[model samples]
Target: MIGTLLTFLAVGIVSIVVVWIVLSVVGSLLGLTMTIATFLLFKVAPVMFLGWAALKLWAWARNNRGFLSAKDRRWLERE
Candidate 1:
C-alpha cells in the first residue's frame, strides 16, 4: 500500500540522517585528536632540542675543559 511505502520512506530518511550525524561526530573527534597530538608535538619539540644541546655541551665540556674559559665554566655550572 502507499501508506506502508510512505512509512518506510520516512524511516529510511531518518535512519540516514542519524547515521550522518554520528559520522560527523566521529570526524570531529578524530580532528580534535589530531589537533591535540600536533599541539603536544609543537610544545615538546623545543624542550627536546634544548635537552640535546645541553647533553652535547656537557660532553664537549667534559672532553675539552680548556675550550671554555673559567668564567664560562662557572656560568655553565651555575645552570
Candidate 2:
C-alpha cells in the first residue's frame, strides 16, 4: 500500500512537471497565462481518475491471477 501510494505520488509529480513545462511553452507562444485555479481545476480531475483507474487495474490483476488476499477479496465483494 505504501509503495503503491509512493509510486503514484512520484508519477503524479513527474506528470505535473512535464505538463507544466509543455503548457508553459505553448502558453507563452500563444500569449496566454494559465491561472493556478484553472490549472488545478483541470489537472486534479485527471490525476484523481488515474488513481481510480489504478485501483480498478489492481483489482483486475488480482482477479486474473487468482491469488487475491482475503482482505482484497472481501473488498472486491463489497464493491
Candidate 3:
C-alpha cells in the first residue's frame, strides 16, 4: 500500500511538471507573437502616414494654383 501511494504521488508530480512546462511554452509563444505584431505596427505606421501626406500634397498641388506664396517658393527652392 505504501509503495502504491508513493508511485501515485510521483506520477502526480510529474504530470503537474509537464503541464507547467506546456503552459510556459504557450505563454512564451503568445508573448513573442505580440512583440512581433507591435514591432511591425511601429515600423509601418510612420511610412504609411508619410505616404498619405505626400499623396494629399500632390493632389493639392495639382488642383490649386500658387498653393505656396513667393516667399515659401523661395524657401523651398533654397532647401
Candidate 4:
C-alpha cells in the first residue's frame, strides 16, 4: 500500500512539472507574436498609409485647381 501511494505521488509531481513547462513555452511564443504584430500596426502601417494618402491628395489638387491654396500647391510641386 505504501509503495503504491509513493508511485502515485511521483507521477502527480511529474505531470505537474510537464504541464508547467508546456504552458510557459506556448505563452512565450504567443507573447512574441503579439508584440511584433502590434509594432507593425502602430508604427509601420500608419506611416505607409499616410504617405500614400498625401501623394494621392497632392495629385488630386494639382489636377483640380482651387482645391488647395496656391502656396500649398507650390509646396507640393517643390517637393
Top-TM-score structure, candidate number: 4
Estimate every model's Cα lDDT from 0 to 1. Answer: 0.93, 0.87, 0.92, 0.95
Best by lDDT: 4
Candidate 2 lDDT, tens digit per residue, 14-78?
99999999999998866544565567779987898899999999989977987978897799999
User: Candidate 1, residue 42: CA error in Å?
Assistant: 2.0
Q: Tell me how far the alpha carbon of residue 6 in candidate 2 is from the true structure, in angstroms, after superposition.
A: 0.1
Please give the distance, in angstroms, between residue 39's alpha carbon in candidate 1 and its true position after superposition: 0.6
Off by over 4 Å in 1: 52-79
Q: Residue-pair clashes per candidate, as listed?
A: 0, 0, 0, 0
Error of 4 at 46 (Å): 0.8
Cα RMSD (Å) between model 2 and the true structure? 24.5
RMSD vs true structure, all candidates: 7.1, 24.5, 7.2, 8.1
Ranking by TM-score: 4, 3, 1, 2
Number of colliding residue pairs in model 2: 0
Per-residue CA lDDT of model 4 for 1-79, tens digit only, reads 9999999999999999999999999999999999999999999999999999999998888778756778977999998
Give candidate 3's whole-model lDDT.
Answer: 0.92
Model 1, CA-based lDDT:
0.93
Candidate 4: C-alpha lDDT:
0.95
Candidate with the larger lDDT of 1 and 4: 4
Error (Å) of candidate 3 at residue 39 is 0.6
For model 3 the local lDDT of residue 67 reads 70
